[model samples]
Target: MSGEEYRIGLIHATMNSVQPILDAFQVHAPQVTLVNFMDESLIYELNETGIVTRNMARRLLNLVEKAVMGGVEGVLLTCSSFTPVVAEISHLFEIPVLSADLSMLEKAIDMGNRIGVIATVEAAGPTTKTLLETISSNKQKDVIIQTVIIPKAFHALQNGNRSKHDELIHQKVQELNRDCDVILFAQFSMVRALETLDFTTVPILTSPEISVKSIIAEITKRRIVI
Candidate 1:
């Protein structure tokens, strides 16, 4: 690390599939160090039900505060289920802490009126539903967000059958494509799998692309401010 080097902390409120998350930063943010923290805080609830409870949201914020203390220029949490948690943290921190989901969903807005959300956990599903409803309504636009849950396969990922996990996702997207105008993967771990998906006629939006950009922009913003 040097004077010009940027240090970033990525908080994963789950034991997130880390390979692609690291790879994305290496390519998109070579000068930045991507320090990571794991919080399987929502694992059971998410896998069983697909909704992020308020209690889980609190842990996510606590992690962001930890990242800030680590001297990171910015923090980005990779799970979509914690979007609100990210927002709540950013409001408290002086440094930038970004919502990976917020950046990714911005792309979904451009794709069309009907959004298809494919999620691995229970918490992400309900949080995404609320996010879509709030944003679409704020713009005076409407969207029909169709949600699909892959709890079994997500557990497979947790237990280490990554290949099986990816295959299940590909299978789910095939069906998801038939019903909505576009597709949005709800987790950062889903990106590597998503890149290989059939993609149908709809666009497949992964958070990493937007999230990496968001991180870079925020890091650069803080550098200028100081």
Candidate 2:
């Protein structure tokens, strides 16, 4: 099937992550139709609870189910903190289901032994760390992972201070570059910070582009027609 025949569903936990993913899709797969489902309250609730509860998982499942019922050819969850939940319900859906960070994590694991994750969201750091550990164990690869979270940057973005957010993340990236073999931006929302800085040394990875490509590849591989 071609890009024009696919309708991709995106579930966003926060509004900040949506634009970057949309921009990537436009450049990489413009013909595909985008179906966005956003619930900004999910971020607030996750921050309040400090973890993804059972009810939170069910809410994510409902969003994916709605996208499936709406005739979407694939569903992608744009929240790093909710990746495990997406994995849990992926078997229930006939269409392709993806977590925004899955492809990025795979790439990071393959790139080097020491991986650094820079994240704006508090919950994302631990979730990504857990994922990296699991993937490394399964692949029988000895990998070292380090995660740094800048809550201030996230709050700055939430308050509409894009420059401040970028500045904070850029500083963290520079610090991490010294020790890590590769750096991965843990949240889809954090990808915007890359525009402000030029880091030519360590390879910096982000979720949106990789996730977009992965979804497109899955659509083609399965020969799913929408």
Candidate 3:
């Protein structure tokens, strides 16, 4: 077990999430091997319907199962919109299963009671807010959560205008910064906007780095040598 290179599965709903997690692994857990399972249709269908359908959940389950079959030691779901789906299926596997946003949110709750959630899509906002609320309740800490949804920026990025996407998100982050004690980017892809921001008084948390750290912590907690 000492020399083993653990393989972790990254399940994604969009290509936007892929690079952020890869970057995180490079910075934090370079020893582990990453396997990505992507289904762009999942995000497209969710946006079209403005809901997570039963079929989407099934597809996510299939992806997770496929990753397990492929010999992954852990599973990380990179889309914040599907975090709740991870909850339902994680118990089915013996390996560590995680939602990318969970560790970030937990850290956000610990950092401040006034948490601002920023998302580039309508689907991610409510899900992130819900997760923050749950974490706050379980911790018995009251929190005020505000969510800003910027779907136009998502469209801009989709159309290959990265500058426009970063501008829109940076502007909203500035506005949120004025009031929030801590801000959390609700999606892994949204973390890119931080590159454009010059400075902020409040702390901003992103999922990928925090998620990778949590994955390593989980592996250690289970006493797995890697």
| Per-residue C-alpha lDDT of model 2 across residues 98-142, encoded as one tens digit per residue | 999988998899999999998888889999999999998888999
Give one digit per residue, the lDDT tens place, for model 3 in 1-226: 1234678899999999899899988878888999999999999898888778899999999999999999988899999999999889999999899998898888899999899988987889999999899999999999999999999999998898989999998888889988899988888888788877877658889999889888777866675454
Stronger candidate by lDDT (1 vs 2): 2
Residue 144, candidate 3: Cα error in Å is 0.8
Candidate 2: the clashing residue pairs are: none
Q: In terms of TM-score, how similar is model 2 to the real structure? A: 0.96
Q: What is each predicted model's overall lDDT from 0 to 1?
A: 0.77, 0.89, 0.89
Model 3 TM-score (2 dp): 0.95
Against the true structure, what is each candidate's TM-score?
Answer: 0.88, 0.96, 0.95
TM-score of 1: 0.88
Please report the candidate that would top lDDT against the real structure: 2
Per model, state how many residue pairs clash: 6, 0, 0
In the order shown, the candidates' Cα RMSDs to the true structure are 2.8, 1.7, 2.0
Model 3, runs deviating above 4 Å: 1-4
| Residue 122 of model 3, lDDT score | 83
